[model samples]
Target: MSHPSMDDMNLNAPHSMGTTIIGVTYDGGVVLGADSRTSTGVYVANRCSDKITQLTDNVYVCRSGSAADSQVVSDYVRHFLHQHTIQLGQPATVKVAANLIRLLSYGNKNMLQTGLIVGGWDKYEGGKIYGVPLGGTVIEAPFAIGGSGSSYLYGFFDQAWREGMTKDEAEKLVVKAVSLAIARDGASGGVVRTVVINSEGVKRNFYAGDTLPLWHEELEPQNSLLDILAAGGDGPAPMNE
Candidate 1:
């Protein structure tokens, strides 16, 4: 039997789908999380996909969509960052990274498609995180979720994220967000990959199935909207309207 080349891998496989979630802390830092599942069609081919990567001492990246595509994109970004730093005599900026990704995606538009989240602090800009799609659109947000399970993760982030959450809070949210995504999205499962980028540096950890922490306690289901309205008791809409 002969092994297949890189070109032989099917980029359109259902299991190839990936998702990532990133949260920016109030004090100017970021936390990112991704699942460790790679699939072929409807079947899971690998359960430990490493989708989070470091581009520089200060910069980190999380990506999703087409494992092969992501690998290529990540490698290119890392290389570009390093080369750009040497050429410009400074650390690569978010704009530079985004532009590099845009150029690469444009060249291999047919073979690869990747969504990247770049986060870190800049000398002049303080802390920042930008999500860049394959089509070159870049946007900033306090928190951003991408990939198949993004919807579920976004819901968790939207409600739990606050203006000044601490590093610990950010870490907990990353774990909870990825766990929720895994539960709701079939293509996302297995271990959870967590990465923290702060003023000091970037730290990464992996949580396997048994080691993963419980996000929210198992609660008896209830009507949340009705409960909220009941709690408010129709009190003049709480002003500031």
Candidate 2:
């Protein structure tokens, strides 16, 4: 019997990436978050970036580093999952997804540099989160944050994450973690893109503008020098001022 061709196997071309991506797990499901900023070295190339991507009905993928490279890895993973489901007659599990990434990286070891986070419910593991580094190494954690802010966000997650936490609580922690990362990491800024993966599928939400707590609400009322000058403030101002 002749085996199906690659295309006949349901695999397609890969996609690329652009920015920072993170993930965390909770009781009901897992949450993936990413910054909407794309940069190379110190130069910011784009502001409205989105790393979080929906791979399947309930599976989600995100990545960081070389926007172009990351996108390819993500697209490849998505295609692999679809093909696996078609060929195996079942949804791709976290382990399979992780292994596929590793194999791809091994195939092009020196040429690829992309960190990824794959999160969703596994048929056997229930809720699962896997962080795959550039070389396809896999790591499991209650929470995982990738990209330039990986270290900073991991610190926050380490402090906030707890076993048996509810999905809502985990979501809040993820937001906080991303907010902190954006504040500290220059390449990781802009809006926070979050996705929740569960039995109900993936739910995406975007928190744009000055929504993160890093912005000071009280400082909003502070008067600018222009405003003060416009008021003709000279010499000694009033005691109230």
Name the runs in model 1 displaced over 4 angstroms.
1-15, 106-111, 213-241
- Reference-based TM-score of each model: 0.77, 0.78
lDDT of 1 by residue, 1-241 (tens): 9976545765445547555545465566777778888778666787787777777777777878877777778787898789889998988776576567777876777776777777776666656777876665677887777888886766567778887777788878888778777767777877888877776777888887556654555333334465478887554465675
Q: Which candidate has the highest lDDT of all?
A: 2
- Candidate topping TM-score: 2
lDDT of 1 at 201: 70
Candidate 1: global Cα-lDDT? 0.73
- List residue ranges in candidate 2 displaced over 4 A: 1-19, 215-241
lDDT of 2: 0.73
Q: Determine the backbone clash count of candidate 2.
A: 8
**lDDT for position 220 in model 1:** 33
lDDT tens readout by residue for model 2, 1-241? 9977766633342332334577888888888888888764444556667788777666777877766777787788788889889998888877677677778766776998788788888768877888877776788766777787776655556677888888788778777777777777666777888898887777888887377785432232234476578898763565883
